[model samples]
Target chain A: MKSIFGKSKELEKNIEEYLDIVEEALLIFERDINRYLEGQYDLFEENLDDILTVENNADDILKEIKYKLYTYMLIPEARGDVLNIIESLDNEVDLCKKVLMQFSIEKPEIKDFIVSDFKELTKQSLKSAEQLVRGIRTYFEEISMVNEYVNKVHFYEHEADKLEERIKRKVFSTDHINDLCKKVHIRHFSEKLAYFSDLAEEISEILSVASIKRSI
Target chain B: MTSFLFISSGLFLGWSLGANDAANLFGTAVSTKMVKFSTAAVIISIFVTIGAVFGGTGTTETLGALGSVNALAGAFVVALAAGVTVYLMTCYELPVSTTQSIVGAIIGWNLFSGRPTQLDVLYKILGTWVFSPILSALFAIVFFKIAEYIVKNCRIHLFKIDMFTRIGLILVGAFGAYSLGANNIANVMGVFTKTSILASLQIGFITLSNTQVLFLLGGLAISVGVFTYSKRVMSTVGRNIFKISPVASLVVVLSSSVVLFIFASEGLESILLNLGLPTIPLVPVSGSQAVVGAVIGIGLAKGGRNVNYKLLGKIGLGWVLTPLFALIISYIVLFFMQNVFMQQVYF
Candidate 1:
């Protein structure tokens, strides 16, 4: 019995650590994107390395959590739901890493007019991801609070969507840039940044359904 | 040897009780994989034996008051009749309980031997049959509310809740098994208590009475049944009968176990009497019906959805039909045992 409880505590600690890493990855993504906007290429590259390291750590902890949940048969009733939540939450971390890596590789030319808009869009998108992590944490520890976090995720996701649309409008309509390719490239990056919030919204839907099923 | 042969029918009844009724205690636990079957089986066998030896006398005395089947042949026939009734009902896919069947068979013996059936005792037994399930339901509702409140307020981690629920299931399953042995052993061995020919034996710091020896034998038979046949029944009960959550299953098991314990416990009765409270009679009640009642209680607690009225009707019908069938079977079997087999079926 003590061993079983010990295994559960270990798994719980691993899950908490994994969530922290995912949250850290999103913070790094937002910071590095701001650095890229400011023309600090060296610091952006350094933070990119930091996010990659965090994402890898999150993946490792996720794998460990899954192994323990399945082999030890913890939470038999909610095992599938918990795994689904964890796997989907991992996708958010992956999206953060993907967005940062794309910015590093493409080095898209950001015109002066839409720079503030890009930074705000990244902040809003990361806010949604941050709320999603909180929602998932509430799902584990305090189920009643999960819906509150889910609603916050949806709110931030909506804010990100608005900012994405504003950035796209500014990029296409402004007379600053002459190259059509540059216009399209800015549009692609804006959509990529906003897509993080969309993914957070999708995961919130899953978390809501799982929480309802879990209620005693 | 003849005594063992005569008591075999009672042993058979005990076996069938174990096979069918152990599921009520551990079905959801095993089916949900919250508690392993091997652990449940071991705990059930040991605690059930302990309960039958120590706590079985109250309900057995109640059965004796209803009608004492004084002859070994008569007791054998009475137990055989109840067992056969249960089998036939199961074959027909009808709900049956050994408690009702044994009660009806003893009443049949009363008629056959030209003895007056004690109307007050019969009424008390009948009243308990009608009351036990309802009481179980009330207990379930209260316990469910308490459990829900704790889960909502405690904010325990899901993994920790899972671990605690697993431990709770095993502990509650043990209690249910003990209550089953205490309450329902009367149905298995009550008829034979009057005619038991077993000699008392001394076992290290304990003296076994003849009745306790009979109960121990009955308890062993029940254990054998649990080991051999209860697994499939637990699966059917856990998966098919109701699709309740593990926490709800815990409440159901706990409620029904409490019902059985109250009905079988003489100590509780004395305490109640001393406190000037109306005492619950020591009568054998159906554990399965109590579980069903508890399930219904949960349904009612959850806004009265998906209650399965048709199943409830069938259970009500079984309450009337099981005992009636047992009485007829007992009457006919006693005739053959006395006339054709040339045995003294009654004296």
Candidate 2:
């Protein structure tokens, strides 16, 4: 964080701290979702509480960054772009908390046959987020590496999309689950998980646009 | 007291110069909130005074050569004519040039006195007026390109670039003010020096020349103008005109300063001549024209569609009318000063 924002120490510290909270929430979101896939529903519930707290913390930091930039006239030339990039980054944390809350309340039971596919979707979605983390970190510290990780995010997002489509077709075509309502629920949750990767991809594009106006 | 009254018209023009041209110095920096108004004011006042006291001679020599108004009454009328031209233009919200206005009034003085106008020297001053803006535009284009390349290719973060630019604006603005003072101070105080009416006085240990004392007073008048009236014009230019990026803003300002400094610097001209290059003329170039040219340069570089041709046409009209009006007023005032007052306006 310090390396990425070395010259402007105060703005560097604030934005770095905000990105840290967001990454924290996202890591917990990744871990909790995987734990649920492994049948540790009780432990997932405990992690869900931490994710919610971090999400709120991320929200507060976003507001704080905006206020500081306004009140102190920080980064007079690039303040608008900096605030916008952080806002987009913070949205990912909000999505994580929302997705975790849905899982906690729904508590959908997965059938044995499609367990491997569901886990595969989870891994791809988490990969998108992990690549997003690296892209953002690189955005601050080393712009040369930004395109590298942002490209990976796009690749993982495409993979997540293909997995989601397969899950949808299989669930609707086969009568393995037998209950129509349960089949729709499983399909809806799978699509939502795929949408997680879509969010990461959206953030990557946002970062790209902001960088165009920022330095280059 | 009589000497002060004799120099009052010059002081009036000095005040107007300070008010209007200070916008060129610190307008972008203050308007963008990169520097506070008070901070800009302090820096501008000190530097302009220093520039006037130390380096005000080069361009004054140009104006002095163009026409030597040897009588105090004649110099007084010329300053008043130019001052009135600037005042009228300011009311119409036109950025007028004191250099051009005073040049026109001197031409008017020559016409009324039946003296031969030095067409060759006049042509050189006129040529610079034409090229100042064009040169400024070229400088701006080159500077903008270099700045754009640096921002895009450098490994530095965006926020830090912005911070650095803010600091850069302050430093460049101070330089601009200094150059402005050195060049434009002649428009305010040049005519009065021909009379040698104000004798040198000792202030503490420093025995300043009459010309330097007159310049110091004129510089203060300009400073007073900057403090009291520049904000309104600065705000208007900052918000209403070209919505430029920080880099573009810096490019425009630095470009104008380069042109103004070139016109005022004999040292730079001799260097060019020593290198077997054509020398730059030491003329009183218009700061307003240079800034306008810079803005146009950035506009063209950004694709030219955003150029405000209507306002520019209006400003060009103002530039044309400024000299003509000053010439007519000075001719009229010189006739009355010579005939009714029975004053010897030309030696």
Candidate 2 off by > 4 Å: A1-7, A49-72, A112-216, B90-95, B201-206, B269-278, B300-319, B336-347
Candidate 1 residue spans exceeding 4 A from truth: A169-180, B91-95
CA shift at B143, candidate 1, in angstroms?
A: 1.2
Compared with the true structure, what per-residue lDDT tens digits does model 2 show for residues A1-216?
234234366666778898788778767877887788789988988766798788788888788788878766766656776677778777778888887888889977677677778888878987897788778776765565678888999999999999998888888888778888988998988988888789899888877765554432
Candidate 1 per-residue lDDT over residues B1-347, each given as its tens digit: 99999999999999998889987788888888877889888999998999999999999999999998899999999999999998987787665689999998998899999889999999999999889989999999999999998888999998887888888889998999999999999899988888859889789999999999999999999999898999988898888875887888889999999999999999999999999999999999999889888998999888899887676887788888898989999999999988899999888
- Residues A19-67 of candidate 1 have per-residue lDDT tens digits of 8888888878878888999999998887577887888898889899999
Interface RMSD of each: 1.1, 4.7
- For residue B177, model 2's alpha carbon misses the true position, in angstroms, by 0.5
Cα lDDT tens digits, model 2, B187-305, are: 99999888987779798988889898888888998999889988877777688663776668888889998888888877787899899998888888888888888998887777786
**Most DockQ-accurate candidate:** 1
Model 2 clashing residue pairs (backbone): A4-A141
